[model samples]
Target: MAIGYLGPEGTFTHAAARELRPGADLVALTTQAQAIALVEDGSIEGAVVPVDNTVNGVVLPTWDALLGTTASRIVADTLVPVTFNAYALTGDVVPEVVVSHPHALAQCARYVSSLGVPSRAASSTAEACASLAPGEVAIAAPVCAELYPVATIATKVEDGAGAITQFGVVSRDDVRPTTDRWTTVFAALPERNAPGSLAALLTPLASLGCNLENIVARPLRGSVDYVFLLFVTDLDQDREASALDSLRAQCSGLSVLGRLAAAKHSRPDGASGIPARLAPVRS
Candidate 1:
């Protein structure tokens, strides 16, 4: 089966796709939105796209595209280190303009700003590196230096140390979880506009022993209304069905996007005040 990735082969998403599905045919797509669309339309068996980064928080464009449709589900996820190398034709070259993906530019903001050059956004970091001209530097993965003619003038250019980006694999079909630890992403609309409405929606899940991992409210297209996206983890696998049922009852509408591998630190710990499930059983 074929899988898609945000690429020109040197992108971190390409690395993530490799990690997610080794030995699979990988197609390079110019944009994550395009990858998501292709997955929804059955153009590809699946696609790997960045969901968020430790340094940049949420990838807005990715989330916006995710909120646009519920047909595509996140089936798997992987993390890639957010490392960048400033590339040019020569080591001594002074760049007049910096180019890379917007998120890459942000991650390496300090380095890009130190160059005293304007930054341009490319479809992907590898694309920027591949298209670099004289006097223009691209902040991309070190792999790009080998993939293209660029030389790494600066290594480890990202602003933060130990920064990582989380990538999710999107597919049209439901994928069975590979592990018991998983996070369910779903969109919900409140029954009404009330101060306690949002709080009330969580009450049901709380009662069902589910942990609210994360939540974001995104504006609806062409309207002032908002849809809440929730990331939930169940302490007990047996309670998941009832937990979803409980949360759905509180919302006017709800859509379960996917249940994928939970990111590290999302699961409950002894220190979290939420007790970890002991002797957990799954069917």
Candidate 2:
């Protein structure tokens, strides 16, 4: 299988892509939009794209890209832990010249503040680590040591290893099993601005026993409407209408952004990427 992930490699999305497919062929793209486009155009069978980070909240740009697409998705998420670190080139341990992905920098804001280092943003952690010299410097993961000619000055710099990210496996069509499947999508409701309009439309969903796994509002820059990324769990072909009806009666400007077909991604026998007790989470 061909897999696409946001990368220059050594990014969490890159890690997720490899973990999800094991030995599958992987392609790395720069931005979330690029990853989604690869799937939309059939260049790859699926993509590993960040949906949200525990500390950074929702990645709006990614959500927007998914919302804008007609692409289908996999419900199973690759939950990876985020632990930002400082990487330096060999003997280059100047705290003032730190380099890293902007998101990484933001996630470890406290550590950065304590160090009071001036950081330069890079596209990926590997790239950032590559730009540095070892000695008195470090990066988030020791897994990056193979790519960059640097040494880690510290590990797990971010307070509490609780920070995590959940990524969506984007595909061209629904690829989940009918049993235990959950569907997710982005939609825009008409009359989103009208008072009680959204509630009136969604009230029936509660009555119909639709359990929402997620419901997030996204800001639309050029329009007054808000986009909704809704994840409905326990979906069957027989029950598609109740969800659709909820959209129609309570919402006017409704549009399906994308759909996700999910099932529990099983752990491979003898696989040991992360411990079950400390399975990474979206903090």
TM-scores for all predictions? 0.87, 0.79
lDDT (C-alpha, whole model) for all candidates: 0.80, 0.66
Best by TM-score: 1
Residues 202-250 of candidate 2 have per-residue lDDT tens digits of 6776777777766787777898767566666666655555677667666
Clashing pairs in 1: none
Give candidate 2 regions above 4 Å deviation: 133-139, 177-183, 211-213, 233-240, 253-283
* Candidate 1 lDDT tens digits, 139-202: 9998887799878888998776667788888888777577866778778888887788889889
Task: For model 1, state the Cα shift of residue 154 in Å.
Answer: 0.9
Error of 2 at 129 (Å): 1.9
The CA lDDT at 145 in model 1 is 76
Candidate number of the best lDDT: 1
Relative to the true structure, candidate 1 reaches a TM of 0.87
Cα lDDT, model 2, residue 123: 71
